[model samples]
Target: MRCTPPPERRDTAFALILTALFGACILLSIIIPSQICLARGGEAEEMNLSSDTALSKLTEGNESPAQEGIPVHVYITNNDNEKLDVSLFIDSELIDHKSISSGSDQKMDRYLLEKGRHTFKITWWDEDVKSSFEVEETRDITAETSVHLYTILNDKPEEYEITVNLVNENSRELEAFLYADGSFKKSKKVGKESSAELGKIKLKEGIHNLSVRWQDDDTKIEYEKTKKLMVKRD
Candidate 1:
């Protein structure tokens, strides 16, 4: 039989080879950046760059039409050294907002609006970032008017008494309908400070939505109020 190296020497030689290979790997790692290098560490997390949840609307009005509507421009910046994806807002209303890579800026514009103040909002989301912003501005509207109305109600067992107060602050007379259970109960004129009292009504109580409608006024001016009343016997 041919002589062969002892088991211990063979084991030692194999171990030395493994050590050399490990050292070479370490040197290469120190010299090269991996394609899958981590962009950022997990020290903190961010949210969506376009995820926002607040909204606001403001109106502006001018006695004379010659005035200008509001003009507004909003700007967003990635203030963090880390690239940020975020949204911006004016007064809780959302404009176009976006993700900003690190050290970048963005801008958006909207009508300042007339007769009321408007809310602007911005939003964003990402795997590790979430943010938002807002602003408010006022502009003048030349020819439109607004009126707000409400209802007062008290409920008794198997019956309800409701008082509808209709007021028109506009220079023109306004009319609207009072409804219950999808049926028109009454139509009344609501002129400047003119209001009518609707008599008591009996209703089976659960969940009900009360809606008020009028024409010749801003279609955006519909007033919807919800009331939850329970009917119980004494």
Candidate 2:
């Protein structure tokens, strides 16, 4: 026959059991999920920008030395629950950077850019991705190219565009110029990582002169090309 324990002893054993159960719950709360990936800001603050960051650029007038350019607008939205650090680049040049809060969006101010193809790259990371340690330094996102609808000039009702494809290089900038009937008509500046286009145009259904010019970044020499483009009915 088993003998019953004293009341005091039974009460102490019950207290010990209660303490063990509480410790187990605390451990589970801290370690059950193991890892959490969150996109948090580099700092607790709202924003951080580069030194040369220009939110927006004013249009250049004809007398101004700056080349006249069009505006490029970018809109980004964060659908995640955590904060995110984002960097923006144009043609391999770092333009701006900021940390956006969770469930919000950033409408990047319009930047003046020469009319042509441009590479708009955005590298982003979460705050709690892997380790807090320098995730921005080891960023792995490649810049994605953007496309826009461009209007062209044409003599006939039918119209077509001439696209200038260039080798993609982060260190090189290229430009292409087009002339029709011996007069300058169109020109395009290709950013470091983008392809240029001459826009859509309808020719006069005859032999026309087309020229392209750019400097060889590797060779440090100027290059030019002239071609005779024939336009006719199929």
User: In candidate 1, which residue ranges exceed 4 Å CA deviation?
Assistant: 1-157, 217-234
> What tens digits encode model 2's per-residue C-alpha lDDT throughout 128-220?
334221112112122332222111111223434444333334345555555555576656665666454456554655577765555665676
Alpha-carbon deviation at 205 in model 2, angstroms: 64
Clashes of 2: 5
Per-model TM against the reference: 0.26, 0.28
Best by TM-score: 2
Cα-lDDT of candidate 2: 0.47
